[model samples]
Target: MSRSLFDVAQSIASVERSEIRRTTGRIARSRQTCCKIMNGSGSPPLHRQGMDYGESKDVQKVHAAIQREKQEPRVGLEPLSLWLIGIYALAVFFGGAYLGRFSGSFSGDSLDPGTVPTKSHGPGPGGGGQQQTAELSPAERGKKVFMSNCAVCHQASGLGSQSQGYPPLAGSEITNGGSRRAAMVVMKGLQGPVTVKGQKYGSAVMQLWESLGDLKVADVLTYERQEWGNHGGPVTKEQIAAFRKELASHPGSFTEADLEPVPADANLPGGEEGAAPPKPGEQAKPGAPPQGSVPPATPGAQPPKP
Candidate 1:
C-alpha cells in the first residue's frame, strides 16, 4: 500500500510542475511581445487596439459635443428675406412720391395759402395788358419807413411804452398840435425830460432824424398826424423843407422847454395860398373863405349888380 501511495504523489507533483511551466511560458511570451512592440518590431497587441478604438470613440463624442454647442458666425452677414427688401423699397418710393405731390413748386410764396401769385401781363395792342404798379400814397410810404425805423420805439399802435420812457404819440398834445412842433422834434430829435399827454418821459433819448430827407420827414409826419384818431392837418414836403431851412441853425435835440414858446395852432410856412374847400363837418381855419363862398371883387372892379 505504501508503494502505491508514493506513485500517486509523484504523478500529482508532475502535473503541478507542468501547470507552472505553462503559466511561466505564457508570461514570457507576453513580455517578449510587449518588448517587440516597444522596439517597433511587432504589430500592436489586441488590447492596445481595443483601447485605441475606445479612445477614438470618446474623442469623436467630445468633438461632436463641441461642434453642436458652437454659435453661428455673425460677421459680414446680410439680410436674407426678399420680403424685408421689398418693404424697404416700398417705403422709399412712397416717401419720395408724397414729398413730390405736396411740395408747392418749392417756391417761398407757396408757403402762404392766402397769398396769390401775381400774373405777368404781356404788353398787347392798345396797351391794355401792360402790368401797372399802383403807387403808394404818402401815408402808405411813411408806414413802411416807420415800421423799419421807428416801430421799435413808438410801436405799431402809436401808443408808446411809458414804462420804457417812450411817450405815446396818439392824441398827444405835441403830436396833435401844429406841424411845426412835430417837424421840429422829428428833424432834430428830443432829449432830456419831456411831457406828452400829461405824462413825463425822459429815460430814453430820441435820436436825430434830419438825415431822412425832407420828403420822408413830411410823409412820416403826415401819417402820424392822421393816424390814431388824430385830427391834425396833413403836412407837405414844401412845408417840411421850409422848416428844415429855418431849423438848420438850431443845433442838437429840443427839450419840452424849447418847444414851449411855439404856438400850438401855428401853421408852417409855404402853405398853398388858397386852401382846398373844407370837407363837410370840418372846421375851416380862421380868416379863410367859407366853403362854396363867392370870391370878393377886385379892388378896381365894381361890385356885381344885384
Candidate 2:
C-alpha cells in the first residue's frame, strides 16, 4: 500500500513539472511580445501566421539564385579556339594556293585548253576540256541541235505534217543529197513550192538559219541524214564551209528549179535516185572540200541559142 501511494505522488510531480514548463513557456512568449511592442531588446513579430519568418526570408535568396541562373546564357557549341582558327587559316591558304595553281586565271578559258572537261575521266569527243562537253556521238550531238531548231516543223520523228504543209524530212531527198544543197538551204534559207516525196509544200516559208553557224549546221545535217529511215552519209563542217563560200554571192533563197541540177561529182552517199545535184559547180568533197571557188562556167563557151 505504501509503495502504491509513493507511485501516485511521483505521477503528480511529473504532471506539475509539465504544467510548470507550459506556464513558463506562455509567460516567456508574452514577455517577448511586450518587449517588441515597447521597443526593447526583442525582434518584431512576423506577419506570417504559422510559417517561420527566417525560413521565409531565406526563400527570397533562393529565388534570387534561381533568377540569376535563368538570366545566365545557356552553354552552346564550343567557341572557336586559337588552334581551330589557325587550322582554318591553313585550310584557306592551301585551298587558295591549289586553286591558283590549277585554275586558268579564272578567265573564259579553262585550266587546260587541250583537255576537254567531261563527266567521264576519259578524253572528250571534240577534244575540248571544258566539263560542259559530254562524250556523245556526232549523231547524238546533232540530234540535240536538230530538236532545238528543226523539230518544231519537222516533228521529233522527222515525219512532218502533210496537212499542215510542213514537208517531211524523214525520207526527203533534201536531207540525203550529201549536204551540199541542204547546207546552202540552211545558210541562205529556202522558199516557194518545194516538192519532197512527190508532195509539194508551198504554204510555209523556210526561214534562214545562218545564226546556227557551220558546226551546228553540220551536226544537224548529220543527225538528219542518219535518223528515221534515211540511210544517207554524214555531213561535215568542210562541206558546209565550201558550200557557203561557193554560194556567198547568192544572197537570196534558192528556188526548187534553181537547186535542180546535181553536179556530176556530187557527194550524194545514197546516190542520185531522187537527190538534187550540187548547186551547178559547187561540187565539194563530202567530208573535205576546197576553201572556195566552185567549177567556173566554161570560159568563152558560147551559150546555146535559145
Query: Candidate 1 on 159-277: residue-level lDDT in tens?
Result: 99988999988998887887788888888898887888888986688998999867778778877887898877777888888888898899689988889999987777888323232
User: What local distance difference test score does each model get?
Assistant: 0.77, 0.70
True-structure Cα RMSD, model 1: 16.8
Error of 1 at 173 (Å): 1.1
Q: Which window of 10 residues has the lowest lDDT sum in candidate 2?
A: 268-277
Assess the local accuracy of residue 211 in candidate 1 as a C-alpha lDDT between 0 and 100. Answer: 90
RMSD to the true structure for each prediction, in A, is: 16.8, 16.1
Can you write out model 2's per-residue Cα lDDT over 1-306, one digit (the tens) per residue? 999999999999999999999999999999889888687556666655533433434777656655655344458955679998999999999999999997777885342113224473446676464445434455666887888778999899999988877888888888765566776677777878889988888767788887766667777777887789876666766666666677668768777877788652356232222232243235656865333436557989987898
lDDT of 2 at 224: 85
Whole-model alpha-carbon lDDT for candidate 1: 0.77
Which regions of candidate 2 are displaced past 4 Å? Answer: 1-134, 263-265, 268-306
Index of the highest-TM-score prediction: 1
